[model samples]
Target: MKEAQKIFSRPRSLRNISTHYCGGCGHGIAHRLVAEIVDELGIRERVIAVAPVGCAVIAYDYWDFDCSEAAHGRALAVATGIKRVRPQNIVFTYQGDGDLAAIGTSETIHAANRGENVTVIFINNAIYGMTGGQMAPTTLLGQRTATTPAGRQIGVHGAPLKISEMLALLPAVKYIERVSLHSPQEVLKAKSAIKRAFQSQIDNLGFSMVEVLSACPTYWDMPPKKALDWIRDVMSKEFPLGRIK
Candidate 1:
């Protein structure tokens, strides 16, 4: 019998350990994508990640590279400062919807507007996963969340924020893509988008962001497989997936 070749292995940029995110959570996949990009670019040693308050706040524990914990909604600002001082290094911010689209809106917009040489990995799972499944800024309209037991009413909760489009309007932003991980094909596309976002910064092109439509199974109260289906069938309707810029 012929020996089978190993098809895959964990990227060296990721620590050889399990993550804390709940089963079916997309943060783990996002982390692996970032690690794979860092490894592929051979910049693991020079990569600095800014992890903000959210589900990924403990990302430093998973990634092998240096990481700084930033306050909620301050990831972009912190990454901006880090990239400015360490121009030789690659700086990226890993932020969730609540942290990025809500509290960090100003920081994120200004950073992209300023054309900061940084990469932003925005995970838009719609509802905030870490803090009791609250309705986040990106939470879809008419979608039920912990805070919106009756489903999100536009009149009361307002329309869902389209952050990627808003950021693409900034002149300094060189790249903006919205991808999802609801299926194998989408995951591949998401990985490609992430690589391009990192490459843009490496080339000093300007601010780049790849908004990933991730799944929050626990909060969504669905199994891992069902959550993915929801992302494809329902969630994607509100936040369409594509390259915004």
Candidate 2:
């Protein structure tokens, strides 16, 4: 029998740790994608990952690159400080919907407005994951969650927050795109978009964002497969995964 060639299938700059996210949670996929990108781009040593509160807050624990923890909803601020002080280092903020589109709205907007040379991986899972399933700003109308048990009512909850569209209008933004991780193909696209965001920053292009429409099966109270269906058939209608503006 011929000896098989040794194949390196894992990332060189990655750490092994049991993730805290529940089964079918999209954080793992996105995290792996980010790690793969960092390794492939050979920037792990010079990259700074800013982890924010929410489900991905402990992300620093799994990444081998230099990482810093940001207060709840202040990832953009932390990333800005790091990128500005050390422009040579690639800075990226990993944030969830609750942290990015809600409480950190001002920080996000201002960072883009200032053309901050940093990458932001904004994960939009619709409902808040860490602190139970609250209706997040990106929560789709008529979607049922813990807080909006009777389904989100447009009259009371108002319209869903269209963040990417809002941000694209700003002149400071260099690259803006939205992608989903609901399937294998889309996940690849998401990784590509994310890689582009980091590359944009590396090229001194300011304010690049790749918003990922991720799934939260536990919070959605659905099976893993059904959760994906919801994202594909229902959520996509509202959020429309693509490069907006």
Q: What tens digits encode model 2's per-residue C-alpha lDDT throughout 1-245?
A: 99999775656555877898999999998999999999989998899999989999899888888999999889999999998899899999999999999999999999999999999999999999999999999999888899999999988998899889999999999999999988999999998999988898889979999999999999999999899888899988898888764
TM-scores, all models, native as reference: 0.98, 0.97
Q: What lDDT would each prediction earn against the true structure?
A: 0.93, 0.91
lDDT of 2: 0.91
* Top candidate (TM-score): 1
In model 2, what is the error at residue 127, expressed in angstroms?
0.5
Task: Quote the lDDT for 245 in model 2.
Answer: 44
Error of 1 at 126 (Å): 0.7
